[model samples]
Target: MPPRQSPAQKLAAKLLLGGEWAPVTNKIGFVKRPVDQAAVEWRKWVQRSNFQTRDGIGVTEHQGTLTELLSKLLPLGYGTRWLLLETANPEWTAVVENTTGDAHFQYVLRHHLSEVRKIPTIEVQDEPKNMKRLPDEMARGRWGGRNLTVYDEAGFRRSLSLYHSEPWKFHHGGEPYDFEDVEQYSAPRALDCFPHETLVHICRNLGLDPFEEDFYVPNGRAFIVELLHDGKRSGGKKYTLAEARAGHDDISVPAVDDPVIGNALYPSGSGNPNPDAIFPSTGFESYARPTPWDRAVKEFEECLKRYSSYPVRASFSDGLEDLGIIALPSLSSGGTGSTDISVMASATLLESPLAIREYTAAFMILQWRQADDSSAFRSFYPNRKQMAVIRRIYKEQGLYPFDAGSNEVYFNLAVDKMIRSVTELRLTKELVDWEASQPAPSTAEAAARANRSCAWDIRMHIQEREDEIWNPELDDRA
Candidate 1:
């Protein structure tokens, strides 16, 4: 007899609306909120299971609907990036993505049929500059960031002889392509069209629509596990790469095209460069090109705009009313803390382009706490240095320190100002870091300029989001 199926190894699995569990096969996953609800937890699961090397994952959902879902899944198998889309899709799973606003693309892949493709494909990017693999870079000729490559996946493989669409044209891989074919100007003749158009073209060419609802096996078991790791997600303090190195006491750099840097970071012959440096993609690939901090702030603002346009589907209760607190929704991405609290967990911004996930309850409790009266936080999470600042701010500002009688609105405004100063304070500290990296200044004038050289501005993260004080007439911006 076949060995009995060991009771589906007790994973923290569940189904929507309490669907029954059973010994299952043909497993697939639906990641509705991978970053917010699942990043750490799902990553932990993958670490334990080595899922990428074992069971394959696919984007069975059509690109017509699962647009953002496509971005979140890239990292699951060695590919993860917003910029890496054009290449990763065909090698991993096919995806179609089209979004309004900036940072957009229309692309698809059929990793399922990648193994079956007979013709080889090519992709040259703007920057193999952002990867740890130089060998891969040297192999895939740099297209000076501009490239014309064949679209070869399991579902659609073509050998188009080039007819000049722009500039000088060359024969398709040296052979003249037929411009006389009736369906010559086909949709997605290249990687420049929507998924629907591509699917239609594939339908005409391959005679199948994998996107049909019936194409997916019914009752594919679903799971809804409470995220196993909920501690704040944060990168370490911002420092130059030269200081974060493994040896030399510390230093680092994001390995890009520079061969010496790549060799230094990955050391030639190191087996399959570590995939943990940043987002995964073939242990290579640049997704989401690094934008300047100003652009990042714009991204954060756009994120806030789209999130309220489509609020998260997770279940949560603010507990603000219970604490008698109020707040404004102004927020920025990244973690925040009340320096006064040393032991209590602080709030953080979940990083994603599609949504903003944050712990606002901490901000609520923080918003209205009067000096010496916030025993809920102060008594349990006292930090001498941070609380001392709070005490000083309360006393020096000529503000009410102990009274909580109808002063919450005024107190919150005071706290907003305090956070503004704190944010400035945070940026101001960067000079110290800069000094550590620089040689001792020979002249006082140079020192003065260096003191003023903090490259970052206040993040404008001077207020809490998602928690609120509901006095309508007080702040019009709110």
Candidate 2:
């Protein structure tokens, strides 16, 4: 016969839930040792069982579905526990509770699938620029100035080619060229129709190098025009005649017959001038042409004009309210407050649309706060020296000093002031009602009553005064 099982070995039993071994706890109770012959026999038979078992201490069996086990385990904080089990099987269910500790584990058993499903493929388009990675020297300036010096020769070449393919031409009357027939003429041919000498004069007036090969070269004329538009020197200063002359010497020109002279030979009609008749036999290329800053300024102005056309309205409330919360059915983009308290208020107001307003407000507040912190005023503002100013403002307004660390100090103070004003107003109204209810008194008493009424009026007026110290109108326009 098999050797008699030890007390520790006989009590061990595995817990299962949905055909899977589950982690168990024995915090509830402890196991009892067998005393009689029948109890001992039962223990011995249990030890000989084929199922997996732990050192027999405290284990309880449970019977339930996986959903039921999860529902029980989730509230107990045993959701992340790992469980051990024997052979995998389906259509089995059980729940095992441990009596050793206040912790329990759950497990599920399932058959492995034979094949895996293929994931869908996706196509990605190439991105133009990663603005974050761009170096400080290469980055575009706030007012729309582009520093093209970061571009390599190849990049510059590609840009020049693009520029030439769509040359901005000028008509005989000095108006900008609007090609009625763009397909029939090359960019250089269209540009050649404009008076070259007149362009040279305009270049001089703009403080640009009129003699630069890039400025005269038919294909590269567009680049020179762009530079004249920008009005900046290579060193980023306002372009002067001296600077322009220096730049004119720096540009490299390819040897080719002048396109303007060649185009002049092509006459139109019977001695009638036809602007579209111009065409060059050979194309010329000019290199190292810089874009003009003026062109960028014009484009920015146009963008601002278009943006201004969009209607935007500003609304204010006594307390923070999300745009979504208002009963206005026409609101498309919702607004919310910057903080948690604001978020709660927004939720009450906006109901289902609170999420959108909360997101928008958070982003806007972050952007504004960042801008404020980064401003020059933050660095230059007097700290301790300004304490006197703050104290004066407080004394004049009869306001108590608040802790600077409090985030809602300003908002709370505003609300408190409003409440005080309302209370004073009600008190004054009561005083008036009392005076009206009383009978006419003696001269001295009447005089005393008048003084009391005037005092109340003064007090109410003081309380109703608005705080204008931090008004926006005080900001410098310059």
Candidate 3:
């Protein structure tokens, strides 16, 4: 519970908010506070920031006691704070625009808890508000004239993912040209689109401290705020947190310690990779928790070769012990939880010829990791020709990802049966899920896993195998 705010303090809070606070007991406000606080770190941060002039939630009759006197919601722990709230498009746009992530949201969330619930609302700004200069940062953001119209973070990444299969050359009949040839456009590194990276960027730009564990946990005390509307925002277009993850994956998200639902959170690589681009050891990751597997077709697409996808030349299979990656064949593809990372063949992918085959092979391995019966997992995608067949069946036969385990013969056979046989599918899953899956968490783990995968019989089977390709035209929709 928050310490009681007095009548004067309530009035001051109203001044701080620049609008009316929610009626305290009615609890009309949303279940909030800690999430918004962790995401934006507003209520206490403004109180603590140093400036010759300041306002809202922090100013006091007596100064110098910033840490001891505040709420106790945002507790410090690994992978804890970001768990409080899920973000969508509207919230993303707002945080980019102002100190408070969303004023409209703040309005909806006012008077939301024990301490925050009591603050009075400011009906109108004093005509002399300008003289106060920095009466509050909220005033500057809300009234300060930086209303955001869109979240540009999702910009053009889809173009990158579709590069190979859906080439600009094929789409518009234009001559071969790179994505960079377009005016006023430059591609963002895979790191730039990452959800966690965006949050770190926002905090540093605000001149506020980043959520690097030590700095974020102590001042975080807004957990008492209830979750209102089931964590969805009111009156917005609502691009889901999942969509953001997809867009980021199409561009960038670093490797986590675990390929799926990582036990450790350090990034293996990032988009920008500058000293600044080097991700903080601790911060928020908007990546959604791993979706549960249907458990039916768990061993769907196992393959033998593992390698660094970049050059498409090196194989880790022969020498897993050298790399230090432990073998988990004790856990077969079926024994392990799936990696959600999927990469698409972006429109601009045509420009990078080398990545085409590499992307195709890696995409297949990822699908193998996640052997769900979802429509996206029903087939392998080695090329555009194969993807076309899957998409056609998706439209004609009515297969959807959410349907998971229950769909009639997708083209003519039940989806799981199709997976048991070799077939081609579309490149629809995001690279984030793809990126997240390729970890040993340690080189030793990678080596050991490879060792298990290629153990005696498996190695003999690989030598005995002939590479088979399915021609989509051969499928008479049967």
Instruction: Give the best candidate by lDDT.
Output: 1
lDDT against the true structure, each candidate: 0.24, 0.22, 0.23
Across residues 1-478, which tens digit of lDDT does each residue of candidate 3 receive?
9988543234334321222211110011112223344333332322222211111121111111112211111111111111122222112111111001112222212212212333221111111011112333222211111111111122111111111111111111112134223321223532222222332333334332322223322433222211111111111122212222221211133212122221112132111112211111222122211223212112111121332111111111222233342221211100011122222222222122332333344333433323333332334322445434444544443432313211211221222223334434322234223433443534332342343221222212222231222444533232
Q: Model 1, 1-478: lDDT tens per residue?
A: 8554221111111111111111010111112122222233233332332112211212121122222333222211112112111111222111121111111111111111122222223221111111123444332211111122233433223322222232212222222233223343343443232122332343323322223332222222111111111123211122112222221111123322222332333222111222332222122111122323334334443433321321111111122122222113321111111112111111112222121212122232344343444322222222344334434444544443523322332343344343343233222334234324545544332332332211112111112221222223323332
The residue ranges of model 3 lying beyond 4 angstroms of the native Cα positions read 1-447, 450-452, 455-478
Model 1 misplacement above 4 A: 1-156, 159-183, 186-199, 210-230, 234-478
Which 10-residue window in model 3 sums to the lowest lDDT? Answer: 142-151
lDDT score, candidate 3, position 194: 24
TM-score of each: 0.19, 0.15, 0.19
Cα RMSD (angstroms) for every candidate in the order listed: 25.0, 40.2, 24.6
Local accuracy of candidate 2 as per-residue lDDT tens digits, 1-478: 9888432123222111211211132211101111122122222322332211232211112233332322222111111111111111111111122111122110010000000111111110111111122344333211100010001112211000011112232222112223223333244554333223333333233233212322211211100000011112111112111222121211122212122322232211011121122221121111112333233323332322221222222222211221112211111111111111111122222332323232223322222113223322232222332334434545565543532222233332323233332222222444334434434433332332233212323233333443332223432313
What's the true lDDT of residue 101 in model 2?
19
Query: What TM-score does candidate 3 get on C-alpha atoms?
Result: 0.19
